[model samples]
Target chain A: MDLHQLWTIVSTPDNVPIVLLLFVVPFYAWYGLRQAFANDRLIAQLEGNPEMAKTHHRKIQPFKAGWTREVHVWPYLLRIEFLAAIIVTVILMVWSITLNAPLEEPSNPTLTMNPSKAPWYFLGLQEMLVYFDPWIAGVVMPSLIIVGLMVIPYIDANPLGNGYYTYKQRKFSILTFIFGFIVLWVSMIVIGTLIRGPGWMWFWPGTTWDHNRLIFEVNRDLPDLFGIAGRAGKIIFGAVVVGAYFLAAAVLIHKLITKTAFNRKIYARMSVLQYVTMQVFLIIMLSLPVKILARQLFRIKYVWVTPWFNI
Target chain B: MPETNGNDGKPAPPAAPAAGNGNGAGNGGKVAAVVAGAKAVKTRAVEEMKGAIKAPEKTDLWKSVLRVKHDETPRSRALGVLSNVFLHLHPAKVNRDAVAYNYTWGMGGMTFYVYITLVFTGTLLMFYYHPSKVVAFRDILYLDSDVPFGKLLRNMHRWGAHLMVIMVELHMFRVFLTGSYKKPREFNWVVGVLLLVLTLLLSFTGYLLPDDQLGFWAVTVGTNMARATPLLGHGGPFGPQMGMTPFNDVRFGLLGGSIVDSNALLRAYIWHCVAIPIIASAFMVVHFWRVRKDGGISGPAPVVLESEIKEPRKI
Candidate 1:
């Protein structure tokens, strides 16, 4: 879309939600990346010079007894906690008084709300239903995420960053999780909560969620978009694409990123079984944005479809 | 014993001699004596003020109510924590690093505080609320309009719930960024994640209690998501094919029927007020206890240079 179209979309009341969803990620990513880079540079400088490193360490270290007078909960932690609670309580009271919690008409199961939504936290999962089959999006994928998060500590062998927040010590894991959390989880939530309107259609922020404004577009698989005629051709093409992605990721991670001996040791320890599973999962996750872009830009959907599932 | 300063009750040096020639020296000494006498009186008053404000060490009215001591021994400190309900969750001593605002963002503490606020406000709301479908909405309306500070109570609970979720998520994010979930902390991290899920569940179930359009539809759509489970959900791919009826599906189990009805309301009520709270509280206890047992919240490893590694005293 041209700048004029973009500006019109943003200017329209109906497109307010769209504008918010579009803007949040790029802004946050830009900010987060700059901060991370600056931190990395500072840490590198400190580590390169021993005297400077000692000073930096001392600087970051919180006040010793003489400096800050740390105390027990009787006077310290409890006081801070209670003060925070009181402040929060006061703010909550003002908010509650000024803006009432929404209470709509009593539910009627017969008349489904035009654009039903889950709570904000689950909006990301709900939005995924647009790109994947329900079995994958709603059930298996969510289950995997919870399980994956719980298992991260066990699988990640890097031990240098257990106590600190240095990105350089744990770059891959930090970058990967950040991408998943922000781009996949948070961005999708913005879309589901704000942009989606009636019939699960996209609506801009200022626009009313009208059922009549639905845009019904045909979404086709990648093979279909490319005019691959037969089922066999599509399957072969899909397999080749999947294989190529995994191969490329494996080679890149191993060759380009795993330069240090510690990194190579960790990579070697991730036997083929572990490496392939993790790589495939990562690629599938990374492909979600690609699939979303394809659907939005080209109106292509179901890049891969089978009797049991579609992706 | 350290000499006490008459002016501040702190240790002070002995009074210096009045400096003067013989003629004025006697007057200067007299003036210094008067000033010292005034300082002594002020110090006595200050000591009394400090005593009055000091936390009670032993309450004869209820001995069990106060257990702390001004001069704590190892045994008394442990006993002080063990005897009190609130103090038991915390370790007697905390590392300075653990309490640093930037290290943990104080998010975990804020979450606990918010949770307590939710419980307090939620209980007050429960006193005014009735869980029936017909009266649920009316009860809320009455609470808002008719009851005294009822709106304030509901508002605090509502906003506090939202804040709790935000705090919990931020806490988890902080933990992730700091790599605080590694090593011996792995299980505590899992517990933390479970607590997060429980918190969301608590918020979700409570959402339906408001009985308005937002809660009703949100719950309806939220529960409907459960029906997409592959073989278990009645509306899922193989569910209908396998002859899975609506009554037997996961959604049905959640709502206690094929649709969101009275049973769903009661279930949400029970889950919100009793079941989830109990489970969450148990997990929270474990989470805190483990934090103490696991050597408190993680901090930066002590800096030791490569050359200093071999120097025993350098560390």
Candidate 2:
């Protein structure tokens, strides 16, 4: 194991945020989930004792008789805000003083940066380029992600867990979000930043980045794997395979959505349009991980390939 | 003469008599009269000054500026937030539990704070920076080696940007996890998503200002993706059939040319320094206003039990 190699990647000024992210994301995730589980416990308690539920102050936060429900923003909320701002300023000042921003040589278009990367945030999209065509990965996926996020409130018909964190209350929506954000978005960014090295090749953490390293693995398309040779036959085979995958995913998701009585109630609340939109987004989202698995495990390059585009 | 002055309704009887006796005694008496008058005036001035210092808020100037009393009373505290231009974004009061760091995580407020710092450092960086390729790199080098705190300035701007992006993502995550985007908050959430896009664009644009290899290559990789924007990009599917080309495509519009060149630098500079900030600020205004209009922070609200699930409202 090349400890120096790991340090080099981790300590690079630009990579620092991703390194920070590795810690920050998990910490916050645990922090949020802790509250969620706590609330879940409280929710279970309240459910069992309907008499107490009617009288109990529903929040896990401590409360007492004759206490004010609200407090002045001036000292209560504004003080915290002021303190937070001061803390942030100190952190930024310290960060700025210690670490200089990365500056490479002057622009020379003739000489290209090996494994040139988009900004760290866009690195997730850049990583997608490996599994899909540029149009789909770069353009379509990003547009869909933004649109899907915007439509979430309109689509989510579950009225429980509206103002508080509770894993049991919002199991489906919470899990779906965690999968999308932490798994797909953040994890991909981490992979793009740390694992993908020179020549955009995967290098395990602590492994030396060998610029000359090559993997002589054959990657095949789905149609080719199925022994389809003719142009028309290949196109038809790919279409059928992609269509089958979607249909299967839809069935599985539907089953999960209606599995519990609570889930069914939530599912029933969704209008037809909301249901369809949610399914389309979920299927598309699921395809990302499925495609990643296909490429990594089976060396499958494209599941569906056409004259103009490939997925 | 002092008694005669007293008859004229003068309250300073002691000072008047002393002055009158001094005047009768000639020039030395006149000096004594002046000294006595000065002593009385000083005592009265000190009393008035002490009263003013003790209750400055009662002064007309203070009242005009603050437009309200600022005592420890709850009414004054409420007015403290409601009366101010900046603090007015917030309501006079908030849910007691909402003020705790656990519920909100303070990410939204922190993100805004970081953005303010970015704008500050960015404005300073612009004073030393020129968008042209010829001097851009040299200017950065000059900033590092010569200009006072210029290196610090650039570093803060750069890191603060990355921090802002991180904070925005976290804020969104917290909002989602807490289910804070339900019902009336749905539109504000949409506004927030737009702001997120604008934040990314702002940072991406700023990446190229240094004209360094890191930025050049990163931007090259970025805009190259634009070239594959299906219908509009020249290299995208059906782009050729629809008359898209390298010279007249989405990528070309973004870069102001076929490649990342002088024009690209200028465009990035303009967008980074001017356009996107304005757009993001406009969205933020609506986002914050809606947060207030939609029933304040979405709570540490009383948890709803599963059995209490209301029937779906029929359209």
True contacts kept of each: 0.51, 0.87
Chain B vs. true chain B: TM-score per candidate: 0.74, 0.89
Question: Can you write out model 2's per-residue Cα lDDT over A1-311, one digit (the tens) per residue?
Answer: 99999999999899999999999999999999999999999999999998989899999999999999999898989989999999999999999999999999999999999879889999999999999889999999999999999999999999889889989989999999999999999999999999999988999999999989998869998888888888788778888999999999999999989999989989988899999999999999999999999999999998877787777
Q: What is the alpha-carbon lDDT of model 1 when measured against the actual structure?
A: 0.71
- Candidate 1 stretches greater than 4 Å from native: A1-46, A50-59, A62-73, A207-211, A226-262, A265-277, B1-64, B71-83, B303-315
Model 1 iRMS (Å) reads 4.3
lDDT by residue for model 1 (B242-263), tens? 6778889899999998888889
DockQ of 1: 0.30
Interface RMSD of 2: 0.7
Worst 10-residue stretch by lDDT in candidate 1 chain B? B306-315
Q: Write the per-residue lDDT of candidate 2 for residues B181-213, one digit (tens) a residue.
A: 997799999999999999999999999889999
